[model samples]
Target: MKIVFALLWLLRLLPMWLIGALAWLLGSLAYALARERRRVGLINLRLCFPDMSLAERKLLIRRNFQHMIRLALEYGVCWWSSAERIRKLVTVKNLHYVTDLRAKGEDVILFYPHFVAFEMGAYRMNQDIPLVSVYSHQKNRELDAQIYKGRQRYDNCYIVSRQESLRSIIKAMRQDHAPFLYLPDQDFGPRDSLFVKFFDTDAATIPGLSRIAKLAKAHVVPVIARRVGNRFELEYYPPWENYPTDDVEADTRRMNAFLEERIREIPDQYFWLHKRFKTRPAGQPRFY
Candidate 1:
């Protein structure tokens, strides 16, 4: 693991175009060799886009693997690169959605999904404003420490452990006025999760976005990041109005619907390697 991190640090010194070419070659090799991951990606695509042909789905999975590798190679850029270099690599759009709220001394929840360039977007956003987000500890202590250091490289950023209670996260947001970078798209098992329609299939999704928003009295601002060739684009949509209504299930469904629309816009950029449908409802067959 130490050697891998050292190699990534060295790779960061290479030109962007060269890094991209390397990503392309390595990504293709990974897609060909990583059978289990490729199978999971295909299963996800088949479940989400049943209307598409097998060849089309396979092509999307191939591109998704390439994007995933590209993101992995850019970890050094996110972890150790200069802020000016990151600013040059990522372009922010409609940033006032969060900034304007912060200016008014209001709490904000950045509704970020599991996009391939998510870390890049978060790093770029952290450059301009402080952020509070959840952190799950990695099993490897060295890897966990490296990720912790990378995430807190900037000043005023707060990372609450996943084991902590909701009150702790809310307190971090209220006290620091940092926008909570919330990622509520993945399946975290059945506990505290509802079977919501992710696309054509039902997915186990947590309603934490709505719950946290209501608890913290924060506005929800949906954000997405995409890789455009070698650079990245971070877009911030307008804040939601009348969110966290009486029905938690409705709010969770609405979140999935919004995610579906964005995934449709850039199908390949969305993360598909994970076993998203791993935890099926009672009596349903396994997806992976």
Candidate 2:
């Protein structure tokens, strides 16, 4: 771990494009050698894009590994770089959704998913707006401390444990009037989850998008973060209209469908390394 941090510190001194190129090189190696991740990414691509040709899938698999590697390497920048430096690297589009809403004293629920550039965008947002989100403790002690502190470096972020009740998250957001950075697309077993169609496949998804919004009385604004060439782009979409309509299942399905559209825009940036369909219905075969 000491050596890893030292290498990251060294890498942080280099130009971002150079770091990006190095990441691509490393990712190419991983694509060739890391059988399980590559296989999982390919499987995800196949499932999500059944209409694409085999050759197209192969190309996407390679590029997705490259994007995944870039995500890994950029963590150093998010951790160690100054706010001014990061500002130059990250550019936002449609940020008025955040500024405008905050001006009106409205609590916003940032509908963020597990995009590759998520950390960068979150780090940026944390600088100006107080962000409250749920986090699971990292397994590594030193790395955990660094991550926790790094995320709160701006003194404008609050993170609760995943095990905590939603009431606590709601209370914190209401008090701070902070934007809740919610990521509800990923699976968390069957508890508090419902099977929703992601790319037309039944995926175990959190039903909190609508519930949390209703509980917090917040506006739902979808945010998309992506790596375009050397820098990152964070786009804040318009707020959802008439959300949390007393139909959790219908709301979750709509959220998943929106994710499908964004993923289609940049298939590689969407998280594909994980076993997305890991939890199946009682008798269904395991995805892994």
Candidate 3:
């Protein structure tokens, strides 16, 4: 593990083009060798995009793997690169959506989805504004510690564990008016999850976005991170109006609808490797 981390750190010394080339080579190999993950990615693509032919989905999967590898290798940049380098690497678009709200002493919840460039973009965002995000501990203690350190490397950021109570996360957000970097996608079983329509499939999703916005009295500002050519772009959309309405189910469905629209725009960048529809409603057979 130490050797692997050292190699990733060494990767930071290489040029972006060289790194991308390396990612292409390695990602292609990974796509060919990592059978289970490739299968899962294909299954996910099929579920979400039934109309697309198998060949098109496979091409998308390959591209997704390439992008995933590029982003993973860039973790070293996020952890060790200078603030100036990161600023140049990642461009923040319309950041005032979160900044203006924070300036007014209003808490904001960044409705971040499971984009491949999420961590790298978050690292860049943390350079300017304090962010409070959830942390799920890994089984390996050393790796978990490293991840925790990398996330909070910027001052004034808070990394709360998933094991911690919701009150703790709320308190962290309240402190310094940091925006909660919430990821509302992914399947976490059925508990506290509503089967929402994700890309025309009933995906088990947690309505935490609306619930958290209501609890923290925060504005739900959608943020997306995309890798364009050699650099990353963090696009912040305007906050949703009249969000977290009395209907929780409707709010959750709306969240999924927004995500589906964005995924359609950049199909390969979305995290299709995840088992998004792993948890089905009762009597439905399991996917994956």
Q: What's the lDDT for all of these models? A: 0.92, 0.86, 0.90
Q: Candidate 2, 39: how far from true, in Å?
A: 1.3
lDDT of 2 by residue, 107-197 (tens): 8899999898999989887776788988889999988888888878887888889899989898778765888899887778988789888
What TM-score should be assigned to candidate 3? 0.98
Q: Output the lDDT of residue 81, model 1.
A: 89
What range of 10 consecutive residues in model 2 has the weakest lDDT sum?
Answer: 170-179
Pairwise lDDT winner, candidates 2 and 3: 3
Stretches of candidate 3 above 4 Å error? Answer: none
- Residue-level lDDT tens digits of model 3 in 179-259: 999997999999999998888889899999988888888899999999888888999999999998999999999999999
- Weakest 10 consecutive residues of candidate 3 by summed lDDT: 152-161
Pairs in steric clash, model 2 = none
Q: Evaluate residue 168 in candidate 2 and report its C-alpha lDDT on the 0 to 100 scale.
A: 84
Deviation (Å) of 169 in candidate 1: 0.4
Give the per-residue lDDT digits (tens) of candidate 1, residues 132-219. 9899999999999999999999875899999999999998998759999999899899999999889889899999999999999899
The TM-score of candidate 2 is 0.97
- Candidate 2 regions off by >4 Å? none
Give all TM-scores, in the order shown. 0.98, 0.97, 0.98
